[model samples]
Structures are given as C-alpha cells and as structure tokens.
Target: MYLFTACCVLCGEKVKANISLCEPCLQDLPRISCCCYRCGLPLKNQLNDTLCGQCQQSLPPIDYLISSLHYAYPVGHLVSQLKFQHHLVHAKIFAQLLLTTLQTHSLYHSIPLPDIIIPVPLHKKRLRQRGFNQALEIARPISETLDIPISTGLIRRAKYTQAQSLLNAVERRKNLRHSFALIKPISAGHIVLIDDVVTTGTTVYELANLLKKQGVKTVGVWAVARATHHYK
Candidate 1:
C-alpha cells in the first residue's frame, strides 16, 4: 500500500509526522559519550574508573553519574522546550532513551536498582509559578519503567538560591550549599537523584552530601543531559 500527502515541516523538508523538527534536524541532536564511566566526561586515555580528573580531585557527593545526552545542539533545544514550553511529553521520550542506553551498558547491570527515586525538589514558589517540576515529570516515567518507588516529600528545597545558570562554579557551590533538606527521616537505601540537566554539579552535590550525611548508601545521579566542558 502507498499513500501521498503534503505537510509543512520546520526545515521545509517533507515529513510524515507533524512535528516541529524535520528528520535531519532531529538527527542533528548530539549524543553523549561513554568515556568517563562514573560521569559522562570525555576521556583522554585509558583509566581505571570512568572519572575525569576534575571529578577525581573534587569528587561529586554522589557515587555515580549517568547522563542520557550531551547538553548541546538539538538536544539542548528539546530540553529547553521541555523545561520552558511545558512540553512534558518529551520527558517520556527522554526517559526511554535513557533506559535503552542503560540497558546496553554492562556497567549499569551490576549496580543495584535504586531502592527509591527522588527528583530534585523545587521550591514552593517556583513550583506554583511553573505549575510543575520538570525533574519530577522526567522521574515519573523512569520510575514507572523501572518499577522503583518514588518519594516526592522526602526531599524539600528549604531555600531558593539564585538560578544556577547565572552563577559560576564557586558561586554556584555557595548558592546551593544549604538549599536542600530532607522533609522527614529517609531510611538508608540506594537512592537515585533525578534532574533534567546538570552543569557544574553543584545542586546534585549538595543533595548527595545531605543524603550521605543521612546515612544513605550508594547515591547515584541520573539526569537527561549534562554540559560538555573540557577538564584541563
């Protein structure tokens, strides 16, 4: 069977589905590398751990970091849409991609499935304004696929700091230093911290630090995208 139809595409390329991006534009989305196993940092030489020197010198509070895509190009555009445009449907697609990537990696198999999933909490003010937390939207699909329990009230944003986008590393660390706190006692267990994107790792570090202090075991970070920066 054959069918013919005409549809307008963003790039003026004919597309079967009605979508904002054409096939070529979608293909231009950047993918993450598998170099540094611990975090997704690009690697230079063979190393024992998949950790870059920057992470090694000043380690992230979480034990492991995994990202589905690099924060660049069309991927970054999609992230912006999901975050700012309220296109929450993108979260499921992003989570599925992450699941597929994780399933293929041998290293991911041995790690224990997180006992619980926690999205980076948003302050009440921001939550009310945005009408939703993007992190929670992403985490919901992941939790559904992995069959892991999710706890929204476990983590709270006690103080809202200046947007991380406006801060440098040192300032970012200071801003996030005391931003997070546990709402109630969380029992010790493997926990996965979910967020839409990670740049300097300040926010996740603060959350991981708090969880570790609370005696949680093996905290790992799972985010949709990570900023690509060369660690010299």
Candidate 2:
C-alpha cells in the first residue's frame, strides 16, 4: 500500500490513489482503439494481418504489440515523471491499469500468457543514475499479480545509445540495432516484453529479434502506454 500527495494531472485536484495521478486522471487517460493489431499503429480498419502501413511495408521483428493506454496527457506526464523525475513507484499503478485493460480487451485471449516477463534492459550507466530500471519496476508488480516468472539477468543492454526521443524512426532503428543480447536461454515459451511506454517500438522490436534468435517461439510487446503520436 502507498499514498500519493501529488495533485492529479487530469482534474487537478489533490487526491489519494495507488499512483501519483488520481482516479479521474486515470479515467481520463487516452487509449488506442483504432490501431493495427500486429504493430499497434493507427488503422482505418483491421486487416487480415492487422498490420499498419509502416508495418505492412516492413514488418517489425515482433509478432504483435499490446498497449494498455495511449501516451497522452496525464499518462505522458506520468511517464515523464517516472523516467526523469525518478518517481518509479508510479509504475505499479500503471501495471495495475494494464492488468485491468487486459481483462477488458478481447486481445487478452488471443495470445498465450507469457511464461516469463522480461523487462527491457537499461545500460549500466543509466541504471546507476536512476538507481532502477523503470521497466523492471513496472514488471515486478505485474509478475506478482499474474504469478509469472521474471528473469532480470537473462537480457543485457550491450551499449547505451542517444535518447530515443531525439531520433527519427530510421535513426531509432539504427540506434537500437544490436542493443539487446540474451545472456542466457530464456526458456522455450511465450515471452512478454515489458516496458513503460512504446513510441517507435524499435527497442521492443530488436529485443524480439534477439529472443527469436535465442530460440523463443512467440514474443509479444506489453507496455504501460503507447505513443500514438510521437515526435519521431
């Protein structure tokens, strides 16, 4: 149990909640309803493959991506606080919301629940500065709730790249190329990539590529939020 004193980003009222943002803020968060099923980008209609325009042109390495909420308004501010302001506790709240969203979404039954939850790895330098990986912070509670095993050391960030926010789509892909390596056998089972947010998805795509190379069959992207509109 935790208490949050910060004002809600949506209604701007001081309130208590599991996360920093209040219930109204959470209720007001934007979501992606009209998006490709495979890659999670905007789409007018669901196709056979359910891949977006960019995804149809050249598929991302991952098979599918599932996001809980849109990366906008209070949700975006929550992410910024977790990443930059060091409010890592907010990740638990985000994970709870993710679980609730999954329960309501039909997509939940389409894929097998991952045998293991693997958080996107952070470079040693960044981990040292932040004192924690935001992805891992979110993954902890999710694992506990779902009773899924979590492997922290199985994946490693090979090197640090420039901020993904500063890079264009092409640059983002190039930046994350060879960025993640599986240090051990991740077990031959469904894998769920856990992260705080998905923008370009280059990070999760590369990780899925690495996982497939490591002998994992099914890989799915699970993020707290998805940036439907991004700078890059």
Candidate 3:
C-alpha cells in the first residue's frame, strides 16, 4: 500500500488514493484505444490488440507491445515531470494505466504474462545526472501488483550513448549500437522491457535483438506512452 498526495499532479485538484490524477485531468490525455499488439503503435479503423499492416507483412522482434497513452501535450509534460522533476508518484498512475490496457486487450482470453520485468537500464553517468531511472520506478509497482519479479543487473548499458531525444531515427539506431551488454544470463524465457516512452523504437529494438541472440524465447515492451502513433 502507498499513499499519494490528495492533489493531482497536473491541475492540483483533489484525487483519490487509487489514482494521483483527477478524473477530468485523466480524461484529457490522448489514449491509444486500438494499438497494434506487436509494435505498440496506434491502429486506425482496426480492433484493439490487432496487428497493423507493417506487422502483418513482416513480424517485428518484439512478440508483444502495449502503450496505453499517446505522448502528446499533458502526457509528455507529465512524463517530463517524472523524468526531470522527480515526481515519483506518477509512476503508480502509469502502472495503473498500463495494467488497464493489458487486461483490456486480453479480455477475451488469457494473454501470457511475461516471466520477468526488466526496466531499461541507465548508464551510471546518466543515472547520476537523473537521480533515478524513471523506467524502473514505473516497473516497480507493476511488478508488485502482478507478482512478477523485476530483474536488474543483468542487462546494462555498455557505453554511455548520446541521448535518443536529440538524434534522428538513423542516428538513434547508430548511437545505441553496442550500447547494451548482458552481464549475466537471463533465467526467464519470457521478458518484459519497461520504458517511460517509445519514440523511434530504436533502443528497445537493439536490446530485444541482443536478448534474442542470447536464446531468450520472448520479449515484450510495455511503455507508458508512445511518442507517435506510427513507427518513425
């Protein structure tokens, strides 16, 4: 059990303990009602949890992906508040939203849950500057709720690559090359990668490829939001 401040982080309206944001404020955020289960990108005129045209032709390395919200306006601002301003309580809200999406998508039948949750690692240098890894914080509550252990110290940043936000998709891919290394064997066959946002899909793709090469059976990405509805 955790305690949250009575006021919402965005509008300062009083909120319940179950959620940090007020209902009206929560409704204002852009949501991905129907997203491609494989890429986690919004799908137009399609049912929820269905594959998009791109994934239909060629499957991606990620076996499953889900992002509850679109990274627009207040959602992006809220992410910034947590990432930069150290508003940690927002992680719980993110976890709730993601859990809702996951369960909603799996309403008809059981969707196999990942064996472990691995929040994206931050290089020691970046970790020092940020004071915390937002991804890990968000993953913590989800792990607690689902009873899935959060794995750490397995995959680490091998090099402090340039920040992804400043780079284009090509540059982002290049920047992340050889950036992550597995320090030990991942015992879990199915794993979930947690991140604050999915922008170009470069970083997760790189890490997923690394895991696949090492004989991991499945990889799923559960992000708080997707920067764009489509892959860049």
Give the number of the best model, judged by TM-score: 3
lDDT of 1 by residue, 65-157 (tens): 777778876677767777778766666657756776677655578788899999999899888878888888878867887899888988899
Put down candidate 2 lDDT per residue, 146-220, tens digits, no spaces: 899888889899888888878898999889988877777767568888998888888888888899888888888
lDDT of each: 0.74, 0.78, 0.84
The per-residue C-alpha lDDT of model 2 at residue 192 equals 87
Off by over 4 Å in 1: 1-27, 44-48, 230-232
- For candidate 2, the lDDT comes to 0.78
Question: Could you tell me the TM-score of candidate 2?
Answer: 0.88
Worst 10 residues of 2 by lDDT: 1-10
Model 3 — which ten-residue stretch has the worst lDDT?
102-111
| Structural similarity to truth (TM-score) of each candidate | 0.85, 0.88, 0.93
lDDT of 3 by residue, 31-60 (tens): 888777788877677776688777899888
